[model samples]
Target: MPSEAFDRFMGALRSAPCENPNRIGHAALRALQDSRIPEDALPCPELQREPCALNGVPCEWLRPPGAPLQRALLYIHGGGWSLGTLKTTRLFLAPMVRRIGLNTVSVGYRLMPEHPFPAGLDDCLAAYTALLEQGFAPRDLALMGESAGGNLVLALALRLKDEGLPPPGRLVAMSPVTYADTLEGSHTSLIPLEHILADDSFVVTKAARLYAPHTPPEHPYISPLYGALGGLPPLLITVGTDEILFDDALRFYQKARLSGVDATLLVGDHMVHSWPIFSERFPEAAQAVEQIAQFLQGRTP
Candidate 1:
């Protein structure tokens, strides 16, 4: 059973108006800075957050007190490719930093409707490349993200493979938008119950069109679910039973496994989308974060 706090949070989120992305993108950038949980609530007080640029793309580095010098994580924030920033996602990143004990780089990629398809991907690729050039070995690095960021992480892995670059050691995608072209999925039936994302206005369809107006929907870089999954590193995916993209994650896991990729999926019953974002408020969220930590630790050399 979900916690009372989780239930209440879901209720409040559902009641909140689903605003237009064009406006939300800018409004969120400002509001989230003030809305984030207090720093005191973060697990790692010794975590040092520094704003920096990677390959010219803005990013923030979170360094836990005892983090290994070589091991690091490239974190991508989710907002349908339009909204979200490091400040907005600090709560989610804090736990990973504390539990996984890795220096984390949260990418602030260019958003859509402004920069579009390859722009965000390019920024992510550049950040990863910069990390490599800085001497972080492929085995010491990992990729992680939620929702659209999840989509970007998976797509980034595939792109790196295609470019003949060294692949990351592991990946964690929470409720990834694996299939962006269509709303075809088992979880589509939960549309009426989904509190965070809607079936039609979701950035996957709306903002995505603006993001990749010219790119084919099934293009591997656009919807990695359509691409080859073989030879990719081990992956861990988590999704909520009630989220609209549950099946997107499920299908991606299935494809990866069928293609001989090591994949694991954790389903949260009666939970909302990206539940791990609320780690401080929900026990399940904390559990999810622990699972990610274990996965990363197991892969780390």
Candidate 2:
């Protein structure tokens, strides 16, 4: 069952496409500076927000259920790495933490065209390193992210392998931002969901350039699709069929199979990127969350 809120949002996204990527960036970045939810409507009661330093890197941990979740999640929000903060995700992260009984640390990494590439990756590695130093075992941690964050999670895993560091137990990637730059047919189809994704006249092709102005979109680390996957941990990719990035998910899945990696792609219908925001209203999102929670909780830490 689709929540009215999700349905309404989908309708509106289709009705009005944000005309400017700058505006999209501004709105999403601005939305982060303020609290987006009512205090009473906060999904988790046991949350502890604190300014913490990881390897001298600034990071915040949104502690979920304290019953020693035993497992920790290093969460990165999506905004093309140019925007998005913890606020963009807590609306769903809070519920996931409570339901799955996990401690989450959401990192607001430095943006691109300034602190581009390795900057964001550095913060993520520092935060993960800090968690490791805090007695969090490799098997007890999961690197999960969305869109750009999803790309970060995957890239971070590769980084760990390169450094000979123990990897996380598994990965939860949600509609990851693949492609180091524009591909031939990235996210330009889906006319039915263009409003949900592209801005007024903007397609994934245009968005890709703005999103990664400096880096080539096809860099293995940037796209992951080009990287060797022999050592990657199991992967769980959740995306929607109606969006432009669906092909990325599909392609990544096939590649993972070729590598003999344990991977699964859960495609949501009538849903767009990060549409799980409708968790409160959409049964599918709730069910999907439950599945992800179970996927994480079921693993032995």
Candidate 3:
């Protein structure tokens, strides 16, 4: 039997068909907005939410006022790297908010086609740098994301390390797309039957290509599998067994482990891309949330 959270999630997701191709282009972004669940359904947490704008970046921050700063999750939303918003992410972000018990700053990165390639990375980086400048310490920061957001989190970690800074407490990646442009594992017949990863990887590749028309397919930041994982922070990666990106997540974990980084790859037979939405009802989602919360807070105890 499907967990209640999973059932609720399916009902919500089934309200609309999620069909987004090419992480770029006007049509794709429109589809992303349409694919999202209802935004007003979530009850605002009592953490004293406040809104503020970064000086130059195109993103917004939701800071929980008067809360003691613990570790932070600098979130990068997924739209195949081309389209997504911080608002659309709340369907799943709420549970993470409660579980990890950290203030999350969801960066609305610039999407591809219009902003292309490093533009998305640049936006995410800007948000991180701005947070540091705004008085947040490195010891209390981590990166997390799903899909393209997953790729961005890893890339940002590398950039931060390359700049002679300490890595975040840890990193979490969900079904990241990290491979060559050929997309050997994403377009196979097995991926489409998966309820969550049913997204067409071929379309995703085309969208990525549209965003970074000039970049090579093997760029480490774009596809971290081709990059070195040396000096990476501890990683907690989750992907569904039936999703197209399953191999991508698995390969990343295997290679990261070989490179001596602490990484855990979880392939759930009953999961799909970013299933934390049914957080209140589903036992699995609840369990996953608690595990992440424990992982985030375990060291404190």
Candidate 4:
């Protein structure tokens, strides 16, 4: 059973207003942008912020007080491919920065229904490459993301491997959408149980189509679960028992381990998708963050 606070949070989210599934293109973009957290109201006053462009891609560096410059993390924000922004994701990113005590670079990648599949992936690749060029060696850097961002984290690693670039020291993915070709497996059963996601609707699938209409969903870059998983860095994946993507994480972990990669999967019983994002109000969120911190610490030199 989940705690009282977790239950309450889910209730609030269930009651929150959502955009109509029929809306697409500019209409969907407008609705998502309108619903975002205002820029001026973003939290995390303790960390010094530096907004800059990395190889032409916009990114922000959030440094906790007294954080070591030697260690760095590239954080990709999630929005199911078409939504989410730096201001909207700061609530989660800020706390992770403080907990991990590293110079965290949050990438503001181009969104879908506008920039599309390769565009967002390109921006993320550019950001990672810029980080490497800036002197953060493979052993001193890590990659982390949630949802669509998590997908990019994995896709980026595979791209890096193909390009002969060294992998990051560690990787963390939370509730990632590993398979995009179909809504099969645990997705079908878990969606109805998860309060944050819809089961009967086509909203998510529509958004995915808008993002990658030309690309095959099963393409390794688009759906990393179908990609090669060997020789990647140590990985830590977290997912809630109630999320539609639970099977995605589990399958990825199993494949990664079979391929001889160091992989750890942490499942939060009765928790919703991206539970770590609610760290401000939930104990489970903090516990997940701590687990990620420990995992990263163990892999760090």
Each model's TM-score, in the order given? 0.90, 0.86, 0.85, 0.93
In candidate 4, what are the lDDT values of residues 73-132, reduced to their tens digit? 999988777766777677678987888788899998998777898999999999998988
Task: Report per-prediction Cα RMSD to one decimal.
Answer: 2.9, 3.3, 3.4, 2.2
**lDDT tens digits, residue span 227-258, model 2:** 88787888888888777778777888788878
Predicted candidate 1, C-alpha RMSD: 2.9
Q: Candidate 1, residues 180-218: lDDT per residue as tens digits? A: 787666446778877777655574655567779999888
Checking candidate 2 for backbone clashes, the offending pairs are 3-281, 179-217, 180-216, 180-217, 180-218, 181-217, 187-244
lDDT of 2 at 19: 41
CA displacement after TM-score superposition, residue 205 of candidate 1 (Å): 2.4
lDDT of residue 115 for candidate 1: 82
Q: Rank the candidates by TM-score, best first.
A: 4, 1, 2, 3
Query: What C-alpha lDDT does candidate 2 achieve relative to the native structure?
Result: 0.72
- Provide backbone clash counts, one per model: 0, 7, 5, 0
Give lDDT tens digits, candidate 3, residues 77-107.
7767755665677656755676667788777
Can you tell me which runs of candidate 2 are displaced by over 4 Å? Answer: 1-5, 15-19, 24-43, 199-214, 299-301
Each prediction's Cα lDDT score? Answer: 0.83, 0.72, 0.70, 0.83
Please report how far candidate 3 places residue 100 from its true position, in Å. 1.8
The better candidate by TM-score, 1 or 4, is: 4
Model 4 spans > 4 angstroms off: 17-36, 200-205, 299-301
